[model samples]
Target: MRAAVFTALCISLSAGAHVLLSANPLPLGMLAALSAGVFAVAFLLAGRRERGYWSIAALLVPLELAADTVFTTGQHTCYGQSGGPVAGSMRSLGLDLLCSGEFGTPLARMTARGEALAGTAASPWLLLGAHVGVGLVAAAWLRRGEAALAGLLRAAAAVAFRPLLLAVAIVTVAPVRSTGRPGRRSDRTRAARPRPHLLHSVLRRGPPCPAAA
Candidate 1:
């Protein structure tokens, strides 16, 4: 429990620092080093635990990616841009990448442009990759050693092999309700209802009120 808590704290601090210091490469580099070192220590702590640390370490990867997406987008809207729609339709691209890995290239390009303009910002791709590396390192260093790595791989495979699980995950993580059109009801309900026949409708209308009399 202590190790899990510490790991979560480290991840939060790392993500928050990245979002806050994204505009300063020097500080971002320093943060990178500091975060790596801290994660190493956290992994070492996980090594002392009996079980479940691997799962915690595994969680760090997606959590870090998600945090980067959320915090960076928020930072961009609040600090990088004026009061507006925020990156148009591509604001949550980072989190979006989780479900659709194809967006990785576009996201990298977008960040590369921003980084070029800022002249000090770190590439989000590199930053996130480094965080993922930290989590993998922690998993490898866990007390269970090879078993931990195997478990991680197995879990990943389970998700990868099952399309339903993937779809369910996308549904769970996506902002479906928020993005959907207002007042739209479920299609299933509409489909289940019995449709009125054209003859029945005509009869109900009583021959169109006798041709309007």
Candidate 2:
């Protein structure tokens, strides 16, 4: 019961976030803008500038993933669900814009589309299936995209910011790279240096030679 209430509260808050976004677009926009900006700034400040380009490119991948998550969620919660009956489903469908955007949170999502009543979930699976179906179709269409820029953008996204694949790869490879230190300590240390952190602590001195000169 407590968990459900908490969930409902959270959903309500999320709904408010979307609805009230105009009240504070600055913060959200700033964060999003900064994520992209810092990625570029840090890259330029570093010697390995190419890495920066790739890192900035990689940032797009997450934003794409976020878009997919939002879109699918909206489709499921707002458009595709079955309600109490066909009539209810029809009514609920009418509320898509509000449900998908203004009230995109769980509490706002109806078990039925109507307020002041328990929402009837049309079919969670059905909603999920529709989302997946649309995703696959969109993916296929995207594959056949006509615009060169679109194709290039997609390709670059996949390479620099591949979602599921990139996430899993990072998790799997990070630990292995970190833990399985080499039989040869120096070489391994050198490899780890750039990836993890700078190694040397102190500055080298040539005071005697300078004094003699």
Candidate 3:
């Protein structure tokens, strides 16, 4: 429960930040804008793991609205003319709610064309489906991806230790080739060579021993 609350708070803050930064006239880079969605999904997965597909389905709308509200608050957005005064400058629940009819958002405009909610034209229902579908797909994909992730980790470990393994193999084989065989042969030859005769040495000194008899 605490994990889920923390995840939700983080997701909301990130989403709000994205909204606030996107309104800046200066280009803030793509990651600054899209990072919220990426982080939100990551937090969702971390909080729920393989369970709670329903939570994702349920939270998508509220999250979107919350982000939209962040964008709308204190924002001055014009409808059509660029140089004209801002049309919807008052406090709003974002463009999705405040701007409509002639000043509608793209989705609202598309929906106003009598296009079916489930048709090729974009609508809230289509957006909802896409959002939920992506979340569900991500959950399913990650659930089944454990083996692949483990294999990748194993492969990385093997690559990291490859040089060490090569060094070990070289150490094991090099001594035998360079010195091992020659040292054994030298020992055998040294053992095989005849030693000086002990009897000959004694005989050379024996003439002095006969006087003792």
Question: Which candidate should be chosen as best, given TM-score against the real structure?
Answer: 1
Q: What TM-score would you give candidate 1 relative to the actual structure?
A: 0.32
The CA-based lDDT of model 1 is what? 0.51
- The 10 consecutive residues of candidate 3 with the worst lDDT sum are 22-31
What is the Å distance of residue 28 in model 2 from its true position? 9.9
What TM value does model 2 have? Answer: 0.21
Per-candidate Cα lDDT values, in order, are 0.51, 0.38, 0.43
Q: Report residue 213 deviation for candidate 2 (angstroms).
A: 62
lDDT ranking from best candidate downward:
1, 3, 2
Q: Estimate TM-scores for all models.
A: 0.32, 0.21, 0.31
RMSD (Å) per prediction:
26.4, 23.6, 12.8
Q: Which runs in model 1 stand beyond 4 Å of their true positions?
A: 1-4, 16-21, 24-53, 82-122, 138-213
- Kindly report which residue stretches of model 2 are placed more than 4 angstroms away from their true locations once superposed: 1-118, 146-213
- Residue-pair clashes per candidate, as listed? 0, 5, 0
Better of 1 and 2 by TM-score: 1
Over 1-213, each residue of candidate 1 has an lDDT whose tens digit, in order, gives 444455556555455445333532112332344455556665674564355655756655665665566545544443344423324455465422222211123333434444454344456556666667766665545535545656787899988889987788998895634535554477657755888678354443435565677
Residue lDDT tens for model 2, 89-192 = 54466543334222233433422322322133543343344444444443343334323445576799888766878778888884444555446887767766
